[model samples]
Target: MDKQPLLRNLETNQPCQPLSPQLLSMAATAAYPGAPQAEELASAPPAHLFDNVTGYEGTTAGGEERFVPPPLSTAEGAGRHEPHPQGAWSIPSITEETAREAFIEYASSKCCYSAKPAKEMVFRDLKSCNTYRYRLESFTESRSTEWTSEPYKGQFVDSSAYGPAPLPWSIIVEIPQLFQDNIEKVPVPHTSSIKGCHSCMAMGRRACTNCTATGRVKCQFCNGRGYKFDDRCNRCHGIGLQCCIQCNGSGTIPCETCDQSGQLMIYIQLTVKWKNNVLESVADQQSGLSADLYEKMIGQNIFTDEQVRVSPIVTFPEIQINQASRKAIQEHQVQLTRTSLVIQQRQTIEFIPITQVYYEWKGKEYNYFVCGVDNKVHAPDYPAKCCCTILCAVPGDLPMASGGQTVPPANMLDKLAGYESIAADGEERYLPPPVYPAYNAEGGQPQSNQQWSIPSISEDTARQALIQYASEHVTYSSRPAEEMVFKELKPYNMYRYRLQSFTESRSPEWKSEPYVGQVIDSSGFGIPPPPWEVPVDIPKMFEKNKKKVQVPNTASVKGCHKCMAMGKIPCNDCLQTGRVKCRMCDGRGSMLGNDTRCNHCMGNGVESCRSCSGHGQQKCDVCQGRGQLYFYIQLTVKWENNKFEQVIEQQCEFPTQKLSKVTGKELFSDQQFQVYPILGFPDPRINQISQQGIQEHWTQFGKTSRIIQQRHTVEIIPVTEVQFQWKNKEHSYFVYGTENKVYAPEYPGKKCMIL
Candidate 1:
C-alpha cells in the first residue's frame, strides 16, 4: 500500500518529496502538550506510526504514492489555546440538586442522638450556565461565463412529386405542323388517336402517297448503282430503290393523341416547399420562435399574384395576414420578408450574517469556545482527597458493662477534629487522628494518616491525583444538530436572436404565353436554288490561258547533262572509254624522257574531264534529259455557303434567401456557513447535584480549607448554501426567406418543308 504526501510546497502547488525518515522532528507541539507518562511513552507499533506500515497485504510491484511526514503542525503554535477534544466544550451538563429536612423520634424510646437538633444542610452548586458566543459569517462565491452563439437557423427547401395539378403542363396542346408552311395544327383526340398521322403516316394501315403505297423510292445515294462509288449499289442491293421516307418502311404513321405508346400522359401538380430548420439552440432549451413572429411574414415570390390568396392559412390567426391592416388603402401589394435581432440585458446581491462570542470560567475570561459549565466542572487537574468527620466529646467513659460497646482511649481521640461518633449506650465517643504533614508552598490541603482512617494522599502524587479526580466531576449534556440557509440576489444579463416563420411556399407571379398561330420558317437559312434550263442562275468566273514551246531534244549520254550532272557517263575527252592516253604525253610512256601525263593522271593511263571530264557527250538543255512536258488546270468554284439556324432552349430564373436565430442561458450554486442563536448551560445553584461531600479537620491542619470551582458555555453553528438561475428567450426567424425557387422548361425545334 502507498500513502499520499501530507504536505505540498505552496509556490509550486505540487506534492513535496518525502525526506529521509531521519528528517522528521519531534511530534510534540502545543496541540500535543504535556508529555505522556513513562508507560504511555513506550514504542508505538508500526501500524500506528504511519499508514501502510503494517497490516498491508498489497503488493509493492505496483507503483505507490510517496508518503511525507506532515510538516510538524507549526499552525498549532499560532492562535493556540488549551488542548481539548472536539465537541468537549459543547457537551452539556446533566446534574440535579435536592434538599430535604425531617425530624423524627427514634423507633426505640432511648435515643443515642438528638432528633430535634438534627439539621439537613444542602450545598448548592452555582452555575450561571452562561455560554461562549460564536458568529459563523457565511462566505459564498459564484462563477459566471458568456460566449458568442453559433447561428443554426436556415431554410429547408423540398421539391415533392406533382400532386393533383396545382400547376401543370398539358400534352393536348397545339403542335407545329411539320413539313408544312404557315400552320399550327390541333388534332382531334378520338380520331387522331386511332388514325394515322396525316403527314407522318401512322400505323401501317395508311399508305404513303410519297412512296406510291410500295414504301420505296429510288436509291439516291448510289443513283440506283449497285456498288460503292457506282461500283455496286450495296445500299439497295442492286434494286436501285429504297423504303419511303414518310412511312419509314412501316407503311403507317404514329398517332399523336396516344404519343405512339398507345397511352396518354396524365398531368399532376408540382409542389415546392420552403421550411425553417427544426433543431433547437445548442445553448438553451427554449424555442427561439413566437407566434407573433409569423405575422406579416409572407414575402414576395411565395404565391403568384394571379393565384387568389383564398385564406391559405387560418389555424394560427396571429400569423394570418389582415387585409384591413394595410394603411395604404390596399392599393399596393404586400411583400413579406423575415429577419432576426439580438436583445441583451445585465442584472447583481450579498447575504452574510454577523457572529461573536464571549465567556468566563474560574475567574478567567475567554473570547469563544466552551470548556466547563452547566453546574459541572471540567477540572481534569483536581487532586483526589479523603477526609473523615470526627465527633468531639468530653473525656468520660461509661461503666464497663456486658452490654457496652468497646471504645478507644481519650488520648487517641484528642487528635481528632470535626468528627462525630457515639457508643451503643447513646453517649458520644471520640478517637484521636495522626499528626498532619508539613505544609507545602501551595498550602491547599493538609495530609494526615490513621490506622482506622482513610489513607493520606502524598504530596508527590498531588498532580496525578488532581487529574484523576476529573472522572468524578466529568458529566455529559446533549444538543440537537441544526442547519441554516442564507440567500442573496445576483444580477445577470443575456443576448439572443429570434426567428419567425411566414409562408413555407408561394409564387409571386404567374406568366403565360397567349395562343397564337406560328409558322415554321427556314427562309432565314441562306440557301440558294440551282437551275439547269430556262432558269436564271449565278455563274462562277474563270480565267484561263494556254502556251506551248518546243524541246531541245533527248539524249542518253552522260555527264554535263541537265538530268545527269555527273557519274556513269564516260569522259568526253576519252570518248566512250575513260582513258585519254595522257594528252601531254600522247600515249608515250614519257615525253622528252619525263612522264608528264603520268603525273597528271597519277600513274593511271586515264584523263578526267573538267566539264564532262573525259566523257564524250555534253548535256542537253531541252526536256532536261529524255522526257515529256506536262500541264495541269486549277479550278475553284465559289458561291454562297449555306448557314443553317441552330435550335437552342431559353432560360429564366428567380432569386430568394434563407434565415435563422440563436439563443443562450446561465445558472449557479455555492456552499456557505450560517450561525444560529446561542445555546444554554445549567446553573449549578438551580440544577441538581448527584454527588456531594464535605470535610473539616484538625491535628495541626491550618484554619484554611479549599474547594473546587468552574464555569463555561456552548455555541451553535450550521452549514448553508445559495443558488440562482437565469434565462433569455428569443425566437428562430429568417431573413431573405421567400418562396425562393428555380424552374426551367424545354421547347421542341420546328422544321419547314424542303424547297
Candidate 2:
C-alpha cells in the first residue's frame, strides 16, 4: 500500500526523513536517554542471557545537510519516477520497559578497573604537574617562504614578524600511573569540598514596554492628571449669570433654599501595577550562543585548516558540575612532547571521537589529546581523490628529502559544485527600450490640462467594471449604491433614515394652538381684583357711584372695601385684603400679655373665639394646616444662561467617589520577565591531571605487558551509521542527520564506545 508522503521540506525537494523507531517511541513517551546510574544492575553481564551481542555501544558521527521539501508536483508522469528510500544514520528503538531495564543493568555494571560494585565507585580528583624535565634532542631546522604563527618574546602587533628558528613543536604525555592492587582496597579520602556564591537573591531585568527601552510611557488616562473634573454647574445656566423669565430681567433669582451658591459635587478612580523586576537578572548565559565544548571544538569542524592539518594538539578538558560539591570537576592531565607524535598525511578526511582524558592547570581539571587532524580542508564533495601533504621536521628521524607540496588555500571552493548550483534560482528578464514620439512636420507640441486624445465616454461593460472597481477601492465613498456594498444592509439603511429625518418636511399648522384663555379684570360683584392688576370697579359701576361708607369694626373681613379704605394691613406682610399679620405674634397664633387672641380680648371686653385666634382663622403649616399662609411657586434657575423655571417632575442621582491614586510608572510596569537555563559546558581549570581506569590494567614498574602498554598511536576517522535496538521482539531504527551526527571514534567498536 502507498504510504502518505512525509512532511515536505521547504528547501530540498524531498519528504522529511522518517523518525527512527527509538525516537518515535521517545516522542510518544516523553522520555529521554539519560546516563545510567545503578551499579548492581549494570554489573550483571548480558552474556548470561544473550551469548552474542552483535551491536556495539558507541557514538556515530557524520556531516549533515538541512533539508526543505519542494512544493507538491502535479505532473502525472513525474509520479512514476519516485525515488527509492535512502536511509541514513539513526538511533535504534526500544520499548520503555526494555530501555529502563537496560539502563538499570548498565548503571549497575562493575567498575572497569577492580571489577567492584559500580555504585560504590567514587570519583576522585587527580593531582597533575605542569613542569617537565626532558633532554634536548637534535633540533631540525625547518623553513618555508610563507610565514606562520609562532610564540614570541615581544608583544604581538599586526606588523610583528616571525623569527627564524629550528622547528619548535613540543609534545608531552602523561606518564600513565600504575596503581597498586591495594589502591582499590584503600578507602578514598573524605573530600570536604565547599563552594561559595553571592547569597543575595538575583535581581531580574524586566523590559519596559511603555518607554520602549527608555523605561517610561505617557499616561493615557486623564492625560497624566492626578485628578479630573466632572460636575457642570446648574445655576446661572453655568454662565454665572441669571435672567428673569417673567420680564426678561437680569438679576439674581431669590432662592427658596440657600440663595444660589451654584456649586455641585463631583467624583473619579485610578489603578496601577508595581515595577518589581526593575534591576533583576531574570536571565543569563542562556541568551548567549551555546554548544557542547568537546563536541564543538574537538569533535566538530570548529578548527581552521592550519589549526587542524598542521595538527595543533588540542588541550580542552571535559568539565562537569561536581555533584558532591557543586564546584567544577576535572579528571587527569595530558602533555604531548613534540618528539612523541606525528601528523600523518591522509587522502580523505573523517570524524574522530574525543578521548576522555583529563588534565590540570592552576588547580583545575582539563582533558587533552592528540589526533590526526585529517586534512578536512582538502576534502571535496565526492571525498578527496588526490592528496596534499605538508611534512614538518621530526626529531630523531632521518632528514627525509626536504621537499613537499605547499599548503593549499584554506577555502578551496572550486572543487564543490553542489553548493553553487543550489544558490542559482533563475535569471531575470531585462526591460525593453522606451518609445520616443516621432518628430512630425515641424512638430512643437502645446501642453493643455485637457487632451483631445482622452476618451469622453467608456463602453457600458467597461464603465460598469470601472464603477465597481472604484466603489471597492474608495471604501468611504457615499455615492456607491446600497446594493453595490458587500456588508449587511441594516445599519446603512438606519443611518440613511436618520440623516433624512434631520431635514424632514414640516406641516403648516404644526405650531398653532386650538384654544385660548383671557384674563378678567373684575372680581365677584363690584370688588377690586389683586393689587398687581388694574382696578375694574369703575367698569362694574354701571353708570352709578355708590356713596362712600366707612367699614364697621365688625365688617373688617379680608377683601372688605371699608376695612381696606381704613388701611389696616401692611402690603408686604398681608394679601392687600384689610387683614394684617399680627405685630405681636408675627402671623402665628397667640400674642403675649393677651388672651392668646386679640389685645382687646382681656381689657376692652372684646374676646377672640380662640379656635381662630382674634382674626377668626389659623394659618396651616401642613398646607400652613389651616390654609392661612399658603402659596404656590414654580421654581426657576438660570442653567447655562437659560431660564428653567419648570416645576421638577422627578430627579435621580448617582453617587461615586475617587477611591485610589495611580502613577504613570505604576501603570506602565505591568509587564514581566521570563527566564531559561544555560546550555553547554563551562570552562575548565587545569591543564593536566591523571585518571586511572578502574577495570583497565595500568602500567606497573618495568613491566613490558600488553595490558599495561604505554606507547601507542591510533588513527581517527569519521563515519556515519544507522542506529537500532530490539524492543518487544521488534527492531527500531533511525538515521543520523544534521542535528544528531557529530564526531565519533573511527573504530565503531572501541573508540567513542558508550559501554
Identify the candidate with maximal lDDT.
Answer: 1
Summed over model 2, clashes come to: 77
User: What is candidate 2's lDDT per residue for 1-755, written digit by digit as tens?
Assistant: 33323245879866544343344333323332331222111212112211111121121111111111112223212222221212222122223233223323443342222212122222122111111111111111111111111112232232212222211121121222221111111101111111110010011121122232222222222222222244223332223222323222421122211112211111000011111110101111121212223122222222122111122112211111012111100110011112122111111111232222222222122232221122011001211123344666643232212111111122321212111221111221111112223213222321212211211212332224334433322112213221222211110000000000000010110010111122222222244221112211221211212222211111111111212222222222222233444444555455554433333232233333343434533332122122111111111111111000101111212000000010111100010111011111111110000011111212121122111111111111111222222222222111111122121112112112111
Model 1, span 168-258: residue lDDT tens: 1122333222212222222111111111222112221322445544566566656444345535566677666677656776645553333
| Candidate 2 wrong stretches, greater than 4 Å | 1-88, 92-94, 104-755
Clashes of each: 68, 77
Angstrom error at residue 743, model 2: 28
**What's the TM for model 2?**
0.09
Position 378, candidate 2: lDDT: 9
For candidate 1, the TM-score is: 0.12
Off by over 4 Å in 1: 1-214, 218-220, 223-230, 244-248, 259-755
State how far residue 314 of model 1 sits from its true place (Å). Answer: 24
> TM per model?
0.12, 0.09
Taken over the whole model, the C-alpha lDDT of each candidate is: 0.23, 0.20
